[model samples]
Target: MSDEEKRVLLNNAWCRDADASFAFGYALRADKFGIVIEGKCAKCGCAIVRCSY
Candidate 1:
């Protein structure tokens, strides 16, 4: 990994895709009562997949 990547990792700012992070979507809650998204790729949807060897 590069020094910049290392710095970001150390700071817990690492993300898989910067563009995808901006991609927003909405879905009904389990109770189907109301919306839950705050207009960002976060909450229970924001995820970062990493592989370790």
Candidate 2:
């Protein structure tokens, strides 16, 4: 996929809620590898987890 497509996919990735207090964001790359996430929990103050595909 092109860089633009990859960027679009990354911007619309899904984030799982396992043990997080805040909603995390994800970004998918064109390599079809894994997803990257950012942000921390507001209540637990723990690092947000990202479930990659």
Candidate 3:
């Protein structure tokens, strides 16, 4: 899936976006750097947690 499409799924989970734009406020800003999501995901809406480093 594409990045935009991934954002759509994230939006569905967080409901951060409802306009189908797949854009969220947090997406523009990052509290920490070098943060990443590991393991297989993006098919069943897994719980991808991110915390500040």
Give the per-residue lDDT of model 2 (tens digit) for 1-53: 47785455444433343443443343323335565444555445555544345
Better of 1 and 2 by lDDT: 2
**Candidate 1, superposed: residue stretches over 4 Å from native:** 13-53
Best by lDDT: 2
Order of models, best TM-score first: 2, 3, 1
lDDT of 3: 0.36
The local lDDT score (0 to 100) that residue 44 gets in candidate 2 is 54
User: What is the per-residue lDDT of model 1 for residues 5-53, given as tens digits with 9 covering 90 to 100?
Assistant: 5334333423444534322343212235432222234333455432222
The sequence of per-residue lDDT tens digits that candidate 3 reaches over residues 4-38 is 85554454432222222222233323345633332
Residue 12 error, candidate 1, Å: 0.7
Clashing pairs in 3: none
- Estimate every model's Cα lDDT from 0 to 1: 0.35, 0.46, 0.36
- Candidate 3 stretches with Cα past 4 Å from truth are 15-53
Give the higher-lDDT candidate: 2 or 3: 2
lDDT of 1: 0.35
Model 1 residue 13 lDDT score = 26
| Residue pairs in candidate 1 whose N, alpha carbon or C atoms collide under 3 angstroms | none
Q: How does candidate 2 score on lDDT?
A: 0.46
Stretches of model 2 off by over 4 angstroms after superposition = 1-19, 23-32
